[model samples]
Target: MKTRIFQLLPISAAVACLGFAGQANADQTVRIGHVAPLTGGIAHLGKDNENGARLAVEEINKKGLTINGQKVTLVLDAQDDAADPRQATQVAQKLVDDKVVAVVGHLNSGTTIPASKIYSDAGILQISPSATNPAYTEQGFKTAYRVVATDAQQGPALALYAANTVKAKSVAIVDDATAYGKGLADEFEKKAKSLGLKVLSHDATNDKAVDFRAILTKIKNERPDVIMYGGMDATGGPFAKQARQLALRAKILSGDGVCTEKLSDLAGDATDNVVCSQAGQALEKMPGGADFQKRYTARFNQPIQIYSPFTYDAVYIIVDAMKRANSTDPKKVVAAMPATDYKGVIGETTFDSKGDLKKPVISLYNYKSGKKALLDVVTM
Candidate 1:
């Protein structure tokens, strides 16, 4: 009996030791929020952004992330705002309730601007991958940050290209009436006038408008050398298609919203007549773009849209801040964000006082044979 008791004691000790080892290496789950219009007309773009974040989260876990000496498992709590301002606010509140340490998303300027206040009030960090409205950062919300350049820069870059490269003497402007569309069109108009381009006419169309013949017919009669559209491809593509159907031969100039890999499908052969500017460096020119593209395609079996690289970098940026702060606490992570100098798939990213990128690059593109081709890259 004594020998049997001794043997059982040793087994019990070994079991206790194994339990302690397991506890020591236990993973602490951390929640990160991603909000985008996942169910709307631009769902593809939102899914692209979510895929980037998910890939980062997966990679981080696979590579072993230790935050403040504890192994951490990142969980992405992705939400859909449906590209509506009211829905955006609701989604923001939901993420806040979910207690995410940081957020990456709200892709549209209209949605992002409304959602930022919720994140700011909750003291959470909100990093936008593609919101280009200057007002997004101008709102004075310390919590708001965007990886891409603002309409203030993108609009002028497109205008300069139209006035100099396209050599357009007169231009007509059109907007989808959303914050991003109108704001970009406004900025483009300001730069176009300063560059001595005649203003033919400016028109407003709702984002959901399908038939643009009335507006396109009016602009066709104006006979402008160029037509600048400030909206997403959903509307802009059809707008361009209708313009061509009306025999309007003017080159269509647009901002990033209308520039997409899917635009050719929407605009058909009229895509050849469209020239657009993206608010960042082209993917092929990004520092880690090629490698990222290969990995992303392998994981998702799909092509990237405009903002996936930015979203991918945004996730890394959030994790970087967590490492710097040594805590997954939202406030602590946010406090560490201002000093960030991390280089990722989108190249180097540094923020200014307004949470805007200190240096931004804009890329111009045009479609040929239903494919987007990079024309030039502008640094600002």
Candidate 2:
């Protein structure tokens, strides 16, 4: 049998000996879990998330970290949740079964929120780099965390920019009806009302629905200055297109959910003058953003999105916590996480008592020529 031989020495002398073989074996494996919609409606987002997480692991292992005095290698356990909550739950349970000490994923709040409870129950630390629903952390789960600011933050900022900067006197609110979409819509409506902007209409649409002609017609009649959408690019794109088709002259405003190159493709000519407030700034804003974008483009042969940088930060947080705790034991790393304040690619990251990021930044952007250009930094 292959045996880990430190040195053939007396039992008393072996106390000082290093078990080289066992160290090598143990050092070559550090498992982390990720769940995202790898092959569903939001596959583009999932692909970006998985690639970002993978890149972080690559960078970490390249640095050659030592844990418990043994060289550590990162191993990812990825699952396709398909942007479905039930599937996300299954994946979370699977990760717990596999005994992953940490996880970074479930891009959508709908999926992340449900899966988070499972991770909390299992004592696994879960950090969502993109899920922004305020309720995700409000569940009082000690193990749940997010790198992005909540929708509550993004919603008000977007509404304020619309009423103040965009000079809108009246606005219409539309949501995809999911937890993420509806929550953002509610916050935006509340803020817009407080800002003295008349709410022309509030509507809900299924994510899979493409025909928004009926709703667009009503919005056109209301003559709102802007129509704000609380949903991802998948639905936001169609809404923009239908608005233009129905000759609705209202300017479009959306939250981070609609901030993607895919939105322009979905909006086509309707993309012009569309404003959005994202969780963070553009690639140029991050200290490492330019380099990361260059490397990410080189590796993936495509442009990166807003959430990827946060996901990169999430992976590093896990690694840093492991190093601080000096062990991969889930409990130790979890305890050490609060003390972590690492300068990651996404900027200075630190969490609050509720596991939400503290002082997270938001940025406004205007979509032009199939790309989102940063307009201004929106502060709390």
Candidate 3:
């Protein structure tokens, strides 16, 4: 009986050793959610944001990081919101339910605002790469953070630039009627009027609308020196293209939403007439801009869009918080995030009390021969 018992114990010990070895070799996946408009008019920009996050995840996994004394692998839970607020909320909840440690998107302000509540309720960290509405961070949600300046800053800067540099006497405004569009347009109008420039007209259009002939014709009658648009490049580009087709000579001005490489292709021959603003420093000015562009292009086989660098930085910021907390738990990461001060591809990043970036910088840009040219940087 003793010999039989010894034989059984050896078999059990062999099985246990195999199990332990397998567990040691396996990596625990830590999911990080990424929400964006991956299947709509602005899908190109949305995909660009996702690609940035994915690149970071892939690189981090390659390094074989161990957090909490366990080999951990980062995973991306990418959800498509189609740039719709309702869809954004749905996906936000889904990501929360999926137990993502942090969220890095919902690119449009309209979507980001609604989705932020879901993340806050779940106590997950959310760092938007492109949503610039002031209301997003002003709501006192501890979980909310953004890498870009708010519309409160971007709108006035563009308006001031138009007043001082463009020397515009009158400006016509058009918005896509989304939260981001109307909000930015309203801010621009306030500053433009304060600067003593006449606002000839302010028109609203749906984002899905492609024809701007009616509005352009009416705007031409006003004969403004500048036409400012508050919307994404998906709509803003066509708006400029149509404005040029109607033979309007007014220069086109817009906020960060319309500032992207895709704008030139979307606007085609009319690209040179458009000048836009971005919420951060120009790429040339960012510490990691050149290396980031090289790596991003190599990974995605595409040029970096306006918000890619921001999203990339956002991913790294979340990881920074996770490492600081020494855990992949969402609550721990959120708690560590308020103190984040990471130097990233965009520049130095530090969030204020309201989750808004401190010392925000804005860059003015124009397109020439299908290339985006930097004009100036305004720091605040």
> Estimated TM-score per prediction?
0.94, 0.93, 0.94
The residue-by-residue lDDT of candidate 2 on 174-248, one tens digit each, is 999988889888989999999999998999997777889898888888899989898888888888888888888
The TM-score measured for candidate 1 stands at: 0.94
Q: To one decimal, what is the Cα RMSD in angstroms of model 2 from the true structure?
A: 4.0
- Residue pairs with colliding backbones in model 3 are none
Candidate 1 C-alpha lDDT tens digits along 131-173:
9999999989889999999999999998999889889999999
Looking at model 2, residue 255 earns an lDDT score of 81
> How do these models rank on lDDT, best leading?
1, 3, 2
Write one digit per residue (lDDT tens) for candidate 3, span 1-380.
99999899989999999999888767788999999998978899899999999988888888877887778888999999999999999999999889899999989999999999899998999999999889999889999999999889999998999899999999999999999999999989999999999999999998898989999999999999999999999889899999999999999999888899988888997989999999888988899999999999999899888788888889889989988999888999999987999998999999888999888999999998989999999996
| Model 1, residue 329: C-alpha shift (Å) | 0.4
**Model 2 TM-score on a 0 to 1 scale:** 0.93
Specify the poorest-scoring 10-residue window by lDDT in model 1.
Answer: 36-45
